[model samples]
Target: NTAPRPWGRNSRNEVVVPFCYLDEETRKSVRDDIILAHNHWLRSLGGTASKDSGHGIKFWEAVNKKGDPEYCTLGPGKSWNDNVAINTVVIRHLANTNKLSAPIGMAHEHQRPDRDDYVRYICKELKDFDAAFERAKRADSRMTEDALCNKPGQAKLYGFRGEDYLMGVTASALALYWPVNKVNAYDYDSIMHYPTLSGDAKEECLTNEQRCHLVRWKDPGNPNDRSVAMVKENLTPSKADIDWVKATYPW
Candidate 1:
């Protein structure tokens, strides 16, 4: 699906499409667009900031809180990548999806919406999530890497692309991990407790239409049992060798 570029930096790199899905021209065009966009952002931010921050050290920074970026003519991630420009980079997952890393959700639409404030908001949010994750990591290591860069799951607070940070870790040996077991129209415990799927725990109590959404992807338990009935029985998380989630947690 084609998505309209927002008023800010283009997040094309975040798309899940593989190389096969995009031609070389399309990729190049996207990259070029990113560069052009980045440069514009930089120029708009009062040029650059070059200061000798230390012995044999040079700190060159061009920031605009409204739409700060690492390099304006370089590409689309300036707001989130530049020093405290918009959001802080927290790899939602490893380069792959299993693990998780995402830009810490630190931007306040109002406070950071202005050009100057954008930089400050990004900086603040970066500091906020980094500190938050670091602190929580002491108790649970996963909390450090696999957490929303924002206020946990606060993406629900406002309707935006804040949750784009999610990437899949090593794909579950889906065939082996999640397989259809049984479809319950009104069974939340079955779907939620299956250890392989995600659905309303109280789905069994829903009507036909409502129950249909009570999807549950469960571990196949046995890879060889990839039968249609078996998959259909499982329902929401079908075992039809498609869209299966690996049962193993990347951690």
Candidate 2:
């Protein structure tokens, strides 16, 4: 599914991305959010410099002769014409759960092989970090600090919610799908990154007492220890995000 599709570019060298909603209802529900998200990207690419500017490439929405945004239908034997299809079912689920900003579908453009490795690395690291924490708790039942804080290969493990483990996995999988270096380090503020409190649409942890039960501390033995939210939800692209896009799709 991560395979690259050859989309056409306009005379201006802007990538023309054709897209459609699964149905009318889905269109009505997410049309605004979709447009907002796309416009954010467009502005960033256009270098408008109004809180969302950085990329050096451009993107154009596929339009008909009337100049209206085209919404094509996807079906069996139907030619997508290099169009990117958005599934309504998934969109509705995200909308209902208040995680509309979380990236999904074709937005992740990394090679499948690399994606698999990244996912495995993140999952294993988290699991090992949790396991080490448990071991330390079993030995000392009253520690007030994270035992794995300074441990090699385990420094990134912070106190994250037990229920949000999947979010961590997803965040890792959807992270900037490109080679990262100190100059282009991991962007914790990228629009693709999910906030710590994301996916909790029902506000399961509304109170201190409720939050206590929902969050998992690295040092379970410490009553004062607290869980940290991994990342904050970013509705717009960051400078690093634009840099990555420009690098990937240079003109």
Candidate 3:
């Protein structure tokens, strides 16, 4: 993905998709298209940014009020690898809606149209009631077609625990819909998974449709499950995540 042509100082030494190899007019047009998109994004933010100084900032301030100093820095996130810090308005919107991270502001992945198909497939194929509906009940007690197929924001807010597991399933599901292609086998260890909330007292009542509190990648494994433990603890992405990001960006 790299090409050397004295393009400029790329201190990051990141993979460079060589668009400059095109004709001069083509390169200029590509740059112009980027600028046009950027300006359009800024104009969209202007509406909320201008309304009240604290509206967006205040949202973050309140959300991160009790966190550490670095956690409370209210601005665009730092860039890493070849990824740029595009904007913060989307981040603000995520916080406002109670989602941990979703730059596109999609509140939940269970609400995606595709996931409905997945659920219907599960209902038809997985006949083990203890393995299917029972587990589904723990995942989201609401378990209704509407609840599973739509964003149950208020229901989730009052019932589910706001932790890595809760957000992991939805976020990981959302990642599937990213323009990025599938780079590897589905990762049960992905942060976008719900924890095995079986014995947890607080999660005992959550519905499968509401948040069954349990999510998996491709299969449910044996008694001692590492993926289940991963959801409960640190959910840093595994090799699958790195591959997914690289493939998605493909610079």
Best by lDDT: 2
lDDT of 2 by residue, 155-203 (tens): 2334432213332122332222222123343445566443434443224
Q: Which ten residues in a row have the lowest lDDT in candidate 3?
A: 53-62
User: What root-mean-square deviation over C-alphas does model 3 reach?
Assistant: 18.2
Give the runs in model 3 whose Cα sits over 4 Å from its true position. 1-101, 104-183, 196-202, 205-212, 215-231
Model 2, stretches more than 4 Å misplaced? Answer: 5-8, 48-184, 200-230
**lDDT agreement with native, every candidate:** 0.24, 0.40, 0.30
lDDT of 1 by residue, 1-251 (tens): 22211122123212121111022233344544434433432232223322211111111234456743233223333223223333222211112211111111111111211212111112112213444454556545654233443432432222212222211111121111111222222232211112211221223323222222212223322222122111122212122111111111000
Q: How many clashes show up per model?
A: 50, 0, 19
After superposing all C-alphas onto the true structure, candidate 2 shows an RMSD in angstroms of 11.7
Arranged by lDDT, best first:
2, 3, 1
Name model 1 segments beyond 4 Å from true. 1-29, 51-106, 110-251
> Between prediction 2 and prediction 3, which has the larger TM-score?
2
Give the lDDT of residue 200 in candidate 1. 18
Model 2 lDDT on a 0 to 1 scale: 0.40
Name the candidate, 1 or 2, with the larger TM-score value: 2
